[model samples]
Target: MGTGKRRPLGDRYQLISPTGRDGPGIIWRAHDLRLRRDVAIKEIQPLFRADGADLDGARRRAMREARSAARLSHPAVVAVHDLLEEGGRLWIVMELLEALTLKETVAHLGHLPVHWTAWIGFQLLGGLRHAHGAGVLHRDINPGNILLTGDRVVLADFGIAALNGDPSASTTVPLHCAPAYVAPERLRGLTASPAADLWSFGASLYFAVEGRPPYPGSDSLAVLGEAVNRDPDPPVKAGPLRRVLEGLLRRDPSDRITADHAARLLSAILRMEGVAVDPPRLPAARLPPDSFAR
Candidate 1:
């Protein structure tokens, strides 16, 4: 169970090969011996240093990710099957999705069709709505975290997600977030909010239709500066999705469109149906009590 050692989990989940790595975790494609299926296992450790604080932080983040994602029961959200701790390392077992990330998809097929982008946006917004209602804020919602499974879109990687009313939700950890997708308010040292996720959603959709991030630069600092100081160049290929993107990307959180409003607009565009337009009211359901407080 130590580093560089390959060990089965409870006589099942034989590790096959390394699939990818995220922040402080290594993802492995494994065979679930009991279920006779393939699963993705994420191994998290403080590989850089043996400092007690760093390892403790990594453990907390892994637990937070599992708890946050476990409460969300939506088809568009990746399922978390199990969490394990062995030899001071944490492992998370998830459904192995046979798909490509939105980032990979855009790289393969530049500038997705307008209707198709709207449909993808609609699905993502649905998942976001559900998460928000459940009081979970998916702080990181970029293209790389969105997966395309066949025709369905699923949001993956809740590593930095936060629950409402948690003190840690407001603490800024720059390394855990993507520079270009970070909200203007977040750049200004504000707390992470649902609006921040909306901004990221807008940026993601912009990348889908434009084949590039809204804020492009040579380095992380440059990208962050652009995100905080300038408006994204108008998207030429967004077509019907233009307005939705605009509303979500508003610099001021108060001015940005609510999740319900964005969903309504995207839904209309997706179905090719028409609806009268007006400002949307807050959803009736209040944010749920913290479900991750175990």
Candidate 2:
């Protein structure tokens, strides 16, 4: 999705700066003309034009991002202020976050303090809890998807899968997740579960501490097989964290840590970091076939 026209996107938004490139989309800082507040807009890339063969299918996938985003209304997830389709392109207007992504933090600071990692883990679990409540599965959960602004933490991308944006039927396999974060079932063309999100979350935590993925290799299949059939190298032996990671990376989805269990386990870490966590919000709709509790 290009700027479309030469004019700066309507008078309603003034482009302040370009953040960076994201696999999910490209984000820009702009001022919301109506609200007079800074906001971010993540518009689909020009991939649609490049892969022009599947124009029809790509259109629906773009629509799915907006739909899934609209289903969620929480502080932790980036708020979807508006979704627009014009000039044969789709754009998502989201809450402009002032903080850096976990990816950037790790890149610049190397490994973070254990407390910080634990705190981030708590926020991610809480966010996932809320997402599950909403009947949404964030098949993609990694360091890049989590953001921290000042003291506030939010999970940026919640729901995504082949059903939503993939040109194919397997949305669980996001290009952004790489091989290190995918669950075992996902690789087999299976739908996503909250437990799968937990598994990815655990892998992200490993990245934070170890600076390496649980399954590090060039081949996607090789990494996934190790992720499913083998155990991850232990974290830096940081007490409950080590145990927490072990449980999170469990090969069996049922054996993995539950979101509730994760929240409870991380409560201490949250308090120790002087972080006051708000309860997660659930989607208004009732349960689905893949209900977390069910």
Candidate 3:
């Protein structure tokens, strides 16, 4: 990322450097003048060359990302601080998370060990559980959106997140999310639920162990078709995680394993192999009775 000048937003956030892009915006590491801290600011640039309708949709999605993420508070989820509209663009203020995305980590390392992948999955499932309880469906769960920060795994980018029963969210786009990670039911135009997210998680876990998506293809259309019409290839390196992966990637959501069940299996994996790093803060395989009961 290149920097030209120190741009100020709302007279509080001082943009210092570019981080990366997420959803429809460019993320910058900015300084909070009032709080004396660094923060991540997502700048949704206006589509100057596009018509009014296209620009409006982008703005709506960007705003939704802020609002949806703001509703959740969890260790494994990114924190949204505020949202502002300035100079004809939307800026989302968020906690400055200094971490590498799971995608980047996997690309550099080829594949992660089974216990390590289980640790990552365990944290993400907790985050997804919390989001679902809040009626916010991530709709997008892939390696690119999973962040690894030391002992924590944070789920980021709620740009296309849909509140349960909110039809408008589903209407934002004809299709959403990375093709290989999309749930089979989503490809068939079915309503997305927590189960859909689990399917995507399963795909991500498969990638972590197999070094490729189960339904790999050269294009989106072909991959989406395979997801909906066929079963994923059997795992060759999942080892102890084979059962859990199969449970999650089942095409029928009804047959999909519940978060609690998945958590139990993940915890078992950690217990059997033992984690090499500090354990996650939260207790493994346990959720509040009122929040997530499968």
Candidate 4:
């Protein structure tokens, strides 16, 4: 079969149609002959042969990254069903989801209702907390990686995620994560950390409520410069959630709000019965002045 034709993988998955592409992987909607169900398969290919890089090493690293993402099991995290090696390619079989990405929703609907954005943030934080506990840092957290299915929110695309303490985690070829959502530390050449994920989460929420990234730019480098040199434009549509976004967007990792604290504020917003009220103040001790000099 050719690249455009439906191809069988092993004895199970039959590739149907291309769903999307991420970095060096081509995602496909496929059918599982044995299970009689649909799955999303990510085909990992070597993109560096033109540059004289090792193809085998790239394949191995992609496999390792898929395995690391499979280790995370949470309702809000997309489930990885299996990994396969066939036809000199690596495939990650995942649950096929039916929903629009948060990015698409924002594009079509503009700013989401405040309560809806809070609900999405709450679920995202839960998923991130679970990943952090499992020693995985989803280095790329943005609107595109967040999906809305019915009333539930799911986080997808773990291609650039890193293991917390593994040395190899830092050495893998970096996939192109959206620079607009990257944390300031990563822009400054620091390694990916949980704090970086939190910063990206804040940017994602900001996008959800404000209809654009905190730092609006035409390209990645421009956005990186803004992220490094400036504070986020204050969120006008965040309503009672403004404080949570403000806390998470702190330039210093040491000063950013903890995931637990963010969860509490979101819970309060969700539980509020009448008109939205400002979330109770987060403890002053946890938030300090920006450590980076102006």
Candidate 5:
């Protein structure tokens, strides 16, 4: 991956075109050569020039993401269809979703209206509750990881997630959107705590309302520094949601709200605003129609 390039397009996928990969995998959108259906493909090479510790960690992580995603069994968590190896490349295929990333959603909406924000928050929390109850900790929760379809919000990108109580799990900085969403303890190589995920959810929703990232600067590193050392500026005119947001974004993980409590809080806000709500769906994401839906 030093060259970081995709494989050449060919007629291998039954003439169906390839899309592209989103994360570490070489993603291609193509017709399943065997299944004969549209699918997304993630290709991994075990012999890439990677740090020794990182190599085994990543391989284990990929296998975990595939299995953890499968066990999630929630409408909001992306479902894994299969994991395969062709030649020297390993791939993971997932369900395709018609959606925009929360990153793209903020770009399009400028800033989400609070009522809609609370409504979406409820759905996100619903998704988290299911995942948490299943003993999965979504360590890499952020805007870009979440997929949105209309008013429906789907949580995606379990690539860097860890199973609860699994001491073998670890965190990857480069894989996360903003280190701000990552728990302070996790930065020190500690295990992920459930409260940390709530902070991420709050920060993600805060970005939706604030337009800019909760901790914005020249780059991810700078934002990370600020998020760790300083409190983020509250969203412009956040009104009553300010307190709720603060509680969720608490730097001390133990002080932050958990998904179940956050869901109840978001529900209260939505009811007060008379906002219509929908059940959260497992929002799917794909590189393209022909290749992978990562």
Candidate 6:
């Protein structure tokens, strides 16, 4: 497709521009012609040369993503509008938001203030709580998948979320996970639970205030080894969040803090510091690398 040309999808959506890549697919900022509104579309490409199993697995994974996300309704959770299989491609239509990803925010500001981090963490916990309540596990949680729009903190990208008790969720093998933020138990090939998500959240929070990931390494394997075999370095800047981080980052899943308790701890920090529940918002234009590609 040329830059001047808009690609139409079944007369319902018109692709404006490709935001970026998402694994084996492309993320597009599209216009819903029928609804006359902007929306984000994840286009999953077909594996042309792969065997039947691989091709079917890809479609199944996409279906799982749509089903997992469609199960929940939360302010902090991004909404999935529809799932379509058009022209041999899987398209996931989602509510589009103008925002900066937590990764971009962190990179732009180096690190966030303790109170702001607390506020974001609190909202994330709320989203996780809702997902868990619905028997969904966000198997992947990291800064890139988090969106900061206005004063609201949104958790996006349920592409790899696991629906509890769904046999298909346990059968598919994950090709990759953000090792720096993945839970230790997950690194050990254990079944993921809400604790795993919390651990990843803790690592993301650690990154928010520290301007770096808790576990350091050059490659994914090295990082996974560090996560599995040792403890993350103590946070020098977490300050009020130190205990919360420690609680969530415990190596043993049984020892990790529950989402509710973590929410309480984060709320306490915000309250003690006299920070407003919804702090001032930053315009997405101010943050560089403005890509809603996750």
For each candidate, the alpha-carbon lDDT, in order, equals: 0.82, 0.70, 0.82, 0.80, 0.67, 0.80
Best by the lDDT measure: 3
Off by over 4 Å in 4: 1-7, 49-54, 171-175, 273-294
Q: Local error of candidate 6 at 172, Å?
A: 7.3
Candidate 1: segments with Cα more than 4 A from true spot: 1-5, 47-53, 273-286, 289-294
Work out candidate 4's RMSD over C-alphas. 5.6
Worst 10 residues of 2 by lDDT: 158-167
Q: For residues 1-294, write the lDDT of model 3, one tens digit per residue.
A: 445364578888988888898865689999999999999988876544444436676688777888899988998899999898877778899999889999888899988899889999988888887887777788888889999999789999898888876766563224436778988888877888778888989999999888888898778888877877999999989999999999999989988998778888888888899664343333343443343345
* Model 6: residues with Cα > 4 Å off, grouped in runs: 3-7, 46-53, 171-173, 278-294
What is the Cα-based TM-score of model 4?
0.88
Write down the TM-score of every candidate.
0.89, 0.83, 0.89, 0.88, 0.81, 0.89
The Cα error of candidate 6 at residue 26, in Å, is 1.5
lDDT of 4 by residue, 71-129 (tens): 87787899998988887778889999998999999999998888888888988787787
What's model 2's lDDT at 104? 82
Name the regions of candidate 5 deviating beyond 4 angstroms.
1-15, 18-20, 33-36, 45-58, 175-177, 277-294
Candidate 2: list runs displaced more than 4 Å.
Answer: 1-5, 8-11, 46-53, 158-172, 217-225, 269-290
Error of 5 at 94 (Å): 0.7
Regarding lDDT, does 3 or 4 come out ahead?
3
Of the two candidates 5 and 6, the one with more favorable lDDT, higher being better, is 6
Query: Which whole-number lDDT from 0 to 100 does residue 291 have in model 5?
Result: 19
